[model samples]
Structure formats: C-alpha cells, structure tokens
Target: MPTRPRSSSSARISSAIVVAATLVAVPPAALAQSGEVNVYTYREAKLVAPLFEAFTKDTGIKVNTISASSGLEQRIATEGANSPADVLLTVDIGRLKEAIDLGVAQPIKSDVLDKVVPAQYRDPNGLWYAASARARVVYASKARVAQNEITYEELADPKWKGRVCIRSGQNIYNNALFAAAVAHYGEAKAEEWLKGLKANLAQKPSGGDREVARDIAAGKCDIGVGNTYYWALMSEREPDKKAWAEATKVILPTFQGHGTHMNVSGVILAKNAPNKANGLKLIEWLVGEQAQKIYADMNFEYPIRSGVKPHAVIAAYGELAADPLPIATIADNKKKAATLVDKVGFDN
Candidate 1:
C-alpha cells in the first residue's frame, strides 16, 4: 500500500533516500498513471519483478506491484467497489479458490487461457488459471539412505525413525500434499499415514523447504519432504546449497503409482477489472512461451503449457508421473484437509 510520488527519473532516484519522510504525503493515484495494472502476490519479488518488467517492455503497459504482503485478501476485499487491481497472482489453489468464493475474481473468457493452461489445472468457470507448477517430493541423503524406491506411506518404516524432516504442517503446501493423499485414499487411511509420519520424524517440522534440504545435508536427518523448485533455487544461489543437492537424490513420490503431488502459482483477473482489454492482453503474454520460460528459469518450476522444457536443474531431477487429480479438487477440499490435519495432530 506504499505509494511513490510521480516525478522525473532523477527525482525518483533522489527520493529513494527520503522514502520515510515522503510516506505520509501522497495517495497512490497521485503517483501512478490511471491505466496501470496493479498486481497483488505472495511470490518472492525478485522472482516476479523481471517478468513484469519484460511484460512492460513487450507491450508498453505499466505494472504496479505489491509483493509479499500478509493481508492480501483483506486488501482485495477493502478495494471492493473501487479496487484498482487488474490482476491477482498467488501460489496455491487454496488462495485462488478463496478469491472465487469471496467473489473477488471473475471468469476470464480468453481462448488462449483455455487452450494452453490445461483443463484440470484451472477453474471451470475461469476464475483463475495457473502459470507454472512445482512438485512436492522426498529427498534422501546419499550417504545414509540406501533405498532406491519408496512411497509416501513408507516413511513410517523403522529405519527412517527419527530421520525425517519437514516444514510446519500448518503450511498450505503440506496441507495440499495431504489433500492429494485424501483424494487417493479415504480420510481414515490418510490419517493413519499422518500418524505414522509423525512417529518417524527426524525432528519436529520446523522450517522452510530449504531448511529441510539443509538438515538432510547437515546429517541431521536422512530424508525430508520439500517442494522441488527450492532445490534448484538453492543450488543456483549458494554453494552450500549445492552440497545439499549433492548429498541427496530427489525422489518424486508416487511416480510408479499415483504420481507426484504438485501445486501452482497462477493469476486471475479482478471481477471488476477496469481495463479488461489490457488485462486479457497481459494474461496472454504471461502464458506465452517466452513468459513461461522465464518462470521456469527463475523458479525451477514446470511450465503449465506443454512442450516448454524446464530449467537444467529440474531436468536433472528427471521426469516423473504427475497425479491425475483435478487441481480444483485440492482447492475445494482445502478446509476439510485442514480439519483432518488438526484432527490427526500433524503438528504434534
């Protein structure tokens, strides 16, 4: 919600130092062109900014971004009848579905979106569609773990006891993974799997996906569950991250059976988006081959569009079967999935 004053480039450069002093002075409209598209997202700013800049370069459209905010839903709701945002981008189908349920997102009627995004990956009503996907899989230390193959239900084996690492169960990513399980097996069986998983923890689930990878490399645990994209990011960003990669082999679970659990970061047009033509144009540009490639390179995720090759690191992980569950199912059952998490004590 912070607004920068409208000024020449030189003045804009100078004001960076006076940001605190300028904070109380202006409304966003005073700073922005009326035709700009506003985006609200949880994606890390570095990962998305360049893409937005590229979109601008291609089309001469201006994008005003608000990244990494916590109260996005409330912000969208508050913008209400007078909302300025043209697009909403966020990770996880849960949030996308929430936007639809709240009536903040309106169905887009783009033929490009329909053809390229895949039928199961998007809302039937077109409230939102994915740009890219990330896989959730297990990582096993090369030095200690000897199993060549494993299943999601096999984590409970006595050999892995006190050696599994994961992030907090409250995270939506983990909840979605569990929901994928629910789709495969009934609730009673999924709860049994959760109980067994808790019994075998390397330590209590405590950190981000990178942290889980770090623990495996540090010899604190032999196996961990984390999103696949983080592995590539870590390997590219820090040398120590490579150590983690070297120590473990990515095991995309359910490959031979149900396929790996996956999730997406996607975009939706606002229900009352003022500039609908520009919005449609922007959506087309995002799902285009060039934009999809940028997403793959920056984040180590798969392009939702077919035939676009993933990044080198992701290719090294090798391809695996993806689950066939309609992604909307994960969004639809998210609340029920959360209740199951609590009922079964995944946090404990």
Candidate 2:
C-alpha cells in the first residue's frame, strides 16, 4: 500500500507507528477511556475522515482510526488479548467473514443495529453489520452501446468478443460476483460461463474498476464491469477523470432470473474492545440517519438504514433491485469461486 498523507485532525498509522512489533500509539489505557474509540479499518483514511470529524462534533467522543488496505484481521489476532482496537471496519462480505472466522470479532447485541440494517446485509449472529452498499454494474460506452439493459450472463455473448474489460477475476469484488453465479447456477454452469466471459476479454484482466471506465473512454472496449461508487468518485472528485465518467452510462446488471449483485462496507465489534461502551455508541450512531446521509453523500454508497435515500448522483443510475442472495451465501462460496476463476484461466 502507498503511504497516504496524514490529516491534521487524525493520525495515519504507518509502518513507523509500530514499535518493538507492537502498535504503540493506541494503548489499552487510552482506548478504555470515555472520550475515544479506536478503529482498525481496511477503508481508505481520506474517504472516512469527514465521517470521523462529524462523529466527533456530534458527540464528544473522538475517533482514532488506523487505516490499512489489508491485514487488519491478522494484526488484531497477533495482538491477542491486548489489542486496543474497538471496532473493525472493512469492505466486502469476504473480509467481514474472515474477521469472524479468525475469532477477532465478537457478536454484537444491539437492538438499533438489528432494526436499522437489513437481515440479508448483516451476519445472522450479529458479528458484522453493513453500513452502506454498492452494486456491481456494467459500464457501457454511451456512443457505441445502444442498449440500456444488460445481464451478467450477456457479457459472455460472442457479439461482445474483445469488447469487455475488468480487473483481476480473483479480486474479492469479482470473486463475490462469481460466488453469486455459483449460488444461482451451480458449479458446472458457472465454470462454463466463466470460460465464455474470459473468451470475450479485450485485454488481459488488470487494473481497478475505474480503469474499466477509462478504457471505455479510450475506445479500448465498448462495455465493461465496475462498481457504482467508482463512477461517482470519478465524476465527483477527480476532475481529470471526468471524460471517462462521461463516456459511459451505468447499467445495473442482474443474474438472468435474479436481481443485481451488491456488496457492502461493514462494521464489526472487536473481541477485545477496550472501549466497549463507546464502541457500541459509535456503531449505533453509524446506522442512524445522519451518519447514513454522510455515507450516501460523501461516499456515493446506498445507506443500509431503511428510508434513507441514496445521493442524487447515485440515484441517477436508477433504483436497484438488488439480488436477494444473502451476503453470507456469497461469502461461503468464495473459495469455490476462486477455483472456478483459475479453472477457466480468467486472467490468462
């Protein structure tokens, strides 16, 4: 992971922050206090700064965030009974499940969480709760593609040969989608579909989802797959990337007989949370309308709270009929999904 510049209000925990193989900045004493909550997150620091600032302003409790692109669960495990982390925040059901499977997360019994988050978007045992969601949708070049509708299975059609672009098939985002295919279509048909989709690749699978839109703008491909949030980020934040955003229209794709595939950015209560009370307070506040609004407006995600609307930018893509597949179902099949990706040589 590249080093992110530090924010004035929040410290960025980097390699230098570790001392004698232990994270030294956030000690258990500090975490146990009433004024602060410590968070170990896989989310980008910059993206979550505003929410933290707002949380502090709304309540007197301060938010101390440790950001890493990966390895958060392992770090907490290595810290053992002395870990100061109060909460774990991450994207994708795969990472959430990993935390539970690793025994680093404890089941949270919160009536607020149970009421605010939908059943399908949370763990049945309450180990994790999704704060927001993103759908995996198709990005089509506005000038070249005439149809507004498309299905995940259609990306494999022969007419789309050499015209589709995507990141690594082994990525968690893609893996979850592949897993969904398995849940809906069984292994044999899913593997056959994977082969067909790989045969249509415009280039070797590489780059992040935003690159799919960039390639579409450059006419490298006519259509590709990406998450809804990337398009919103490009359009709202990166001025130089506006052309790419303008080049394509987002089409919410569904499994042939099912609805759109969706994923989440979720929260978990650490097993060894030192500030358990403050941690619970923060988790409850996160699902409330005010925080959900921040998630929608600042992050371009669909809020998990019932009755909260998505930001206008996301709403423009049209309402999503998210596939009713439970996140746990998709997570359970992740290893099998990876196997199919390899069996079909998706990135080769």
Candidate 3:
C-alpha cells in the first residue's frame, strides 16, 4: 500500500495521516497506544486533521488515523478484537448505520453528546452522533429559475420537466435524502416523487453535486439538487468554480409540511476500542465549541451543536429548518429507498 507518514501533531497538513492504510504484519501489541487513539475514517485526512490536532493540543493525547474512501468498516471487522480503531469519523447516517450493522460500532453513553447533539441527529441507541450536517437542497439557476422558495414535492411538478440535474440516485447522499422522503411520505408516494424527479432530468443522472451546479450554469438544466456545502465551496474557494457558484442560488426546500431534510457528518465509537476512555474524550470533545468552529469554517458544514453558528457563506443561504425525523428513521428506510431507485430506474 502507498504510505505518507506525518510526524507533527500541530501541522495543518491535509496529509496528517501517520499510517494511511492497514498494517497487516504488525501485531496488535505494537499498535497499542499509551497516549494515543487510532481512528479509521471515511472523511479525507486533511479535512479532519484540525480536529485531531486540537484534541491532541488540548489533552496531550496523540491521534493515529488511517483514512479511506470505502471499506474502513470492513477493515475494522477484519481486524476484529485486534482492531486498534478507537473512533470512526465519517459523514452520513447511512454509513454510520453500516458501521453499526457490520457490528463495528459499540453503543456509547455520553451526557455531553446527548446535550450537544439533538435527538433527531444521533442514534437513539447511542451508536453514533452527528457533529455536522448539510442539507440536500436545490441549486436553482439565478438566470433561469425565478422562484426563491421550493418544496421537495415541487421538484416533480410538470413545470420542472427537463430542468433537473442530479448525481446518481444510488449515491449515499441522494439515498439518504430519498430515505427521508420515505419517512415523510410512505414508500409508495416517494416512488412517485422519484419518478417525477427523474422525468424532470435534463440529462441522465451523472457527476457529483458540483457537476450538477456546472450543468445548471451551462444551461443544461434550470435547477438541480445538491448538498449545501459544494455551492459554498465553489463560491469561496476554487476560482474556476466561482462561475458555477455565481450562476446559482440555494433554496432551502422542505417537505410539504415538514422542515428541510438533513444529512450528517457523524462519529462512532469503535466496538473494541483499545483506549476506550480516550476515544470517549475525543468523541465528546468533537462536539465541543472549538471543534464545531472548525467544522463551520474549514469544512463548510452546519455545526450540529446548538450554539455554534454556520460559516458566513452558508448563513447567507438563509436559516435551515431541518426535518425533525430521526436520522435513524431515515437510515432504516435506506433499503427501501434503494429498491425504489432501482425500480424506477432513476439512474438510467
């Protein structure tokens, strides 16, 4: 496996990974930590480095992280009790549930977590908690789309036919959103909505959310569905993407009567975490005000903590009224949502 080891605890390097992949030959004893926590994350190493650095700075405990886009949960399972993974940091409740269902996550009970994160955003069994969130909202073209407000149901209206652009419906982000729709309206109604949304497609569902913005800017579509952050990132960061951002405005859409659907970036305590106490500390500290601030500014996501404000770029979109349905509820509907996606051939 390719390796890029980092030595500094204080460096803001995106490559803050000590060992970026699994250690097969080394025994679990060598992996033991006297004052460190091993983390397996689906999130990019650089995006999560500041949180680890802050945790280490405040408490003097080192963080050892191995980051991957996919299969870290399976890696932990393969390591079994020998797995040194103390905490799993990742985004989306669907993946969090996957960790739990794979038996890689253990239940946690933290008063700090319960108080800092709302009930709707955490696992009821305490297996995981959302540290940050991003809403699945429409990216309407400023030049073409006039309506400032939209409902999830409105994406299906006959008026929007040939105007919607989106990524694959099978994507975890869209899956979670579709699952939320199942929770709000029954699976049957959600199927109808999915079909209608698919009918509105200007082109076959392709590319990630940022590409959806590109298509809207290019006049391939008038509106598209995407997470809140990609637009914010485009607006503030990449000079090349600034045109895509400038051409569109975000609309915080909701279910007919309910609030906007929210997907999360959450954390889980490893089932056989070697340094359980340290892992718990890291988990709790993640929800603390300081870490939440990094999430707001650096990650460009909404802090799940009550008192934390969003980054100004995100705040400009307007207040987000997140749907009260528990993330677990949305997660429970994933299989059903995925089935509906296939049944409707939304990707085709």
Candidate 4:
C-alpha cells in the first residue's frame, strides 16, 4: 500500500506525494519501455495490489501504481502528451466516463475485452470496460420482513413507509440506481417514484451501505437498500459486524421485471500511456479467469467474465440476474437523476 501524503495544489507537485502516490516505482522511460505499466487508480491500494502482483508473477512485467481519491482525470489532462499513465482504474461508470470527457483516456480495441465483458458493461466505442459488478439490493430485517421478494417500486408502497433506510440519494451508487429508474420509467414517473420512496424514509438519507446494515440490525429501520458485498464482508471478513448480517437477509429487488440494477469497478486506457502494450496486457488479464477469480474471491465482487462465479460468500446472496439495461444508458441520466434528488429534497 502507498503511504498517505499531503497534496499540493499544482499538478506537478510530484504525484508520489499526493495525487500521484506510486506503490512501486520504475523510472518512466527506462523501465516502462522494457516491461512496466504505470497505473493511476481510484481504487484503494490494498484492494488491487494482489491482482497487480499476480499479473507481474505470471508475465514478469512490473506494475507501478499511483492511487488517488479524485482528480486523476484532471491530473492526466494537465500532463497531456507527457503523461505516463497507462491505465486509469476506477469504481464507477460515471468516473470512467469523466476520464473520457476530460480527454485523458483513449479508446482501445481489445478482442479479449470485447469477448469477456458484456455489451452493456463496456463502452460501445471500447473506451472502458467493467472488470466486476455489484447489485443494488435490499437488506431487510430477518425478524420483521418475512417475504423474500421485493421490487424497486415496492419500496414506495405505504407498508414500507417510515421503514426504509438508505444512504444519500445523491451518492453515485444511488444515483446509478435512480438513473436506471429514470431510464426504465422515463422522467415523469421516475420523479413520482423518488418522491414516494423519499416519503418512506425511516430517517434522513444518510450513511454508507455498511451502516445501512448496522441500522437495520439496531432495529432503526425494517429495510435498507445497499450493495451486495457488504453483507458478505460483514458475515465473514468483519467479525465486528457479523451481528449486522445476522440481523438481516439480502433481498434481490428489481425494477418491475427488468432485473437487479448493477454497477461496476472498471478501467480505462490513458491517451498518453507510455507503456501502452503492458497496460493492454493488464486490462486483458483482468478479465481472464485467473484475475477474475482473484477479484471475486478477494474483493467479494461479481466477476465480469462470462463463466467465472462470484465468491461463495457473495454467491450465497442468490443469483444476481442483472438488468439488461446498458449501464451507460443509466449513467447518461446522472444529471437528471441528481436534479430529481434535489427536487424532492431526498436527503432532507
């Protein structure tokens, strides 16, 4: 893991210190040309390190990573033609699109990516590809909510009023789900649905997905919408949070019969990637069965590859019949989605 460092305002403030903290260093021109890839990522260092290591072990190519919370797109833009970024690793389609919008990423034609990732999970132009997925699902009180099945529309039903606990509707996760709603139902009905769901809030929309589980366990609410992996994390990896998982059960909710709304952790190729070949190799490797298994087993995420299965811990949630809606279609509605979020004062 890269050590935390203070960031200076200027783009050249040495990325190693802040916006560009590198986990492993290979002098730009020398090692990059020989056998190394420079990666600028938004994912946590610990989460992606193993995959990088395995890639290195298998191919004998070096991996150097610069991890960040935000501004990677802008940073790459500032560096322009001189940028060493080979790949941009990020969690959401919105961020992936942002990199493209900033003109820092370029499209790549990869047969491996085209074959492994579904059409809905990648850019039609091949700009980015999702490596793994997670569904927006319900964590319902095991003791209170008896039925296993529920729909996204049902959250607005009067019976669930004053019972739903959720994070800020403005968060990217919820925005994606809400955007899916807008795409599925169109603007007018989507707004009405948001208003209804907001009216059913147990309290103000607040907290992360795990806290939603915590709140449900405390009986603060009867049900909450969260991602798939948090329940698995609580059940196995996080002993301290086991009671939260025990107090609730995962319910796969759909948009009517459209199937569960899903999101992804994805990657992009940098326009000025100095080690473009290595970067492409890494991207292709990520969707291969080996890297897919590492992602599934270690990250508790659903693999993007066709035949690979999710970690047993996550698979126990039940089959994730993901909605057929193109993720980009849902992401495209982000502006309208956020507008609806504020229009309804969902957080209030």
Q: Where is model 3 poorest over a 10-residue stretch in terms of lDDT? A: 10-19
Worst 10 residues of 1 by lDDT: 17-26
- lDDT (CA) for every model shown? 0.76, 0.87, 0.87, 0.87
lDDT by residue (tens digit), candidate 3, 2-23: 2344457522332322345432
- The CA lDDT at 292 in model 2 is 92
Q: Estimate each model's TM-score.
A: 0.88, 0.93, 0.92, 0.93
Q: What shift in Å separates residue 114 of candidate 2 from its native position after superposition?
A: 0.6
Candidate 1 residue runs with Cα over 4 Å from true position: 1-27, 30-35
Tens digits of lDDT, candidate 1, 51-77: 888888998887766653344545566
What's the count of clashing pairs in each model shown? 2, 0, 1, 1
Please give the range of 10 consecutive residues that has the lowest summed lDDT in model 4: 1-10
3 or 4: which has the higher TM-score? 4
Q: After superposition, how far is residue 211 of candidate 4 from its true place, in Å?
A: 0.6
lDDT value, candidate 1, whole model = 0.76
What is the Å distance of residue 94 in model 2 from its true position?
A: 1.2
| Candidate 2 lDDT (Cα, 0 to 1) | 0.87
Question: Which of the two candidates, 1 or 3, achieves a greater TM-score against the reference?
Answer: 3
Find the candidate with the highest TM-score and give its number.
4
Off by over 4 Å in 2: 1-25, 28-31
Task: Give lDDT: candidate 1, residue 3.
Answer: 26
Q: Arrange candidates by TM-score, highest first: which order?
A: 4, 2, 3, 1
